[model samples]
Target: MHLTDHDRAMRDGAEGDAIAAAMDLLIRYGEGLGAEVLCDVRNVAGTSTQPTPAKTIIAKEHGWDKAFSVINLDSDADIAIPPMRVPTCQLQQGFNDEVLSISPYRSELVELQDGAESFASEKGINILATCTPYQVGNLPTRGEHVAWMESSAVIYANSVLGARTNCEGTASTGSAGLTGRIPCWGNHREETRRGTHLIESDVRVESFLDWGMLGYFAGDVVGEQRPVLSGQLARPTLTDLKHLGAAMATSGGVEMFHLPGVTPEARTIEEAFGDTVPATTVHYTAADRAHVYETLNDQGSSTDVDFVLLGCPHASVEQMAEIARLLDGRKLHPDTRLWVMAPRALRDVADRNGVTAAIRAAGGQVLTDSCPAMSRTAPEGTRVFATDSAKQAHYLPAILDIEAWFGTTRDCIEAALTGRWKGELR
Candidate 1:
């Protein structure tokens, strides 16, 4: 791989030991990916504060700087960590302290996370603490190069915003945050960004649920390759596209997709494919949509729902307001619980808008910073769960050994109210 003068200087230890270590990792990573050169990036979203047993051990024995050395930089050397060189934000981590009494999560872990947040903030890392950073303040422009770790965010960046990035990992993003450079491979190149598959949906995909089902079907049909979507589709909102992208990334390793007229990269189907013909053309009909829905709901067999989790990638302000409206005059069942996960910034907006108050009055809570899947904990004695998010429905069952029912927002709210899974594919 070729490196510029600045990159070479960093690797030669001119910028201090920590930055040298980060450059070393980036060079190795770029070589492993067979990239020819390194690209400059100003935006980076990654995980740093999440508490793990390994990080805990490292911090206890060697201090937080040493923990960052071994975990974030993949280096064993003892070096003084510096403030991030570029714009960087921390991603979703363990649950906060507020949920400890109601949840089975360890209080020690929450305290550990609180300390971790302080450390990251001191290092100049913005503690966004949510998967969906674009919805917050870090909206990357079209054609902007970024290093983002979350799968859903990666897809949204490449597909929705036209920003270029691969589905980065913890270490790569860590390095990129310090050096502002990433391997120019995969989605970074213009030619490789073209679509590899064409999915024409014959079924009417207008609702949030329909888009999610279609995204799941597209991911299953074309695993890691990009897909260009056309045919019966509605002009989706930000929330709808968020659901679609999250669902696709959950079901398969989809990093990027194109909705042709909807997305930014491609204005037409022809442009999406470029000079290359689509490798496969799959038609997403009603039967295909039903199959995806059934697959999402397959884990659930019990009707007595104990938990209804919303926001796999964290909820937007619109989704929060919608939930408040759904639970306006209703109260949750005594046996069931509902939690709406969102970013703290957006949660503040919801609080100011009376959205949080309305949901709280109806026995629901809008929590922020972390989710059950990240923390690996849920409400006590939750054997069955229902969610409006396709990603959560696809993951929670395997993560928690629980049953999941996938449906619309109203369906999930109804389950929270009546303690039953009466939701069906509509």
Candidate 2:
């Protein structure tokens, strides 16, 4: 790998042990990936990554700082870790102890999460612990470079916000936070960001669910390549875009996509493809939507919804407001449980606007700083599950051994109210 004098100095230990360690790791990464240079990352969003312990640490014998380094940084170096050079925030943790009653080791897990938050904060990491860090304050501009860990956030930053980043791992992002550098490969290059496939949707995509199906279909077809969407998409809301990007990242390894006239890169179809015409064109109709719906929901039509989850990408303020509106005068069935998850900042905003109250009045929970993917715990006797997020529906069934069903947000609310799955894409 070719390194500038500064990088070489860092690798040679001129910048002390911590920076030297980081630079060494980066050089190894660059060599392993055939990258010739390292690029500076100005925005980072990966402080909440919890390393699985090899064995249980039964007692607090070591200090929290030391334990944090061992668990998060994967290093036990004596040097104190430096602050992030750029804007940085945490993604979601495992679960919130104040609300969740599922984890058997609830007390210990919460302690570990709290320790992680405090340690990262002391090292200048903004511990928001929400997947949607942009909702709080870490909004990166178009074309700006960043190092992000959350897959959904990576896709959103790359495809929707036009920021450049690849889906980074927890350890690599920690190195980026320390050294502010990453390998200039993959989506970091401008050439790889262009559309390689064209996707057309004949269905009118107005809601979040419709956009989600389009994204899932397009991403599966194109795989890791850039997909140029030539569909008639209305002016979608932020929630709609979130659903699309989240499901796209879920179903496929898509880092970025271009939607002509909607996303930043594709002002026109020609702009998306540059000189080359799209190598392949895919079409999505009502039949495609039905297929996606069937693939997502493989459950029987019965009155047996044990759990109904919302907000896989973490609900925005507008989504929360809409959910509140839907549940204003309604009551959930006694057998059903609704879990609404989002960033703490947005939850506070919803609380101020009486949205949280409306949800709680209807027996729904507004949880923060939790990712269902990380937690295998569910409500006791949970057999049938329903969710509005395509990402959640894609994973929960296989992970939790429950019958997961996908539907519209309205359909999920109706399921919560009546304890039934009455949604139809047909």
Query: Top model by lDDT, which number?
Result: 1
Query: What would the per-residue lDDT of candidate 2 be over residues 180-297, giving only the tens digit for each residue?
Result: 8989998888887888998888888887888898888877888888888876678888888888888888888888888787778889989998877788988888888889888887
Query: Which ten residues in a row are the worst by lDDT in model 1?
Result: 110-119
| Whole-model lDDT values for every prediction | 0.92, 0.80
Best by TM-score: 1
| TM-scores for all predictions | 0.99, 0.94
Give one digit per residue, the lDDT tens place, for model 1 in 329-348.
Answer: 79999999999999999999
* Candidate 1: residue 175 Cα off by (Å): 0.7
Cα lDDT of candidate 1 equals: 0.92
In model 1, the clashing pairs are none
In model 2, state the lDDT of residue 350.
94
**Model 1 CA lDDT for position 374:** 92
Off by over 4 Å in 1: none
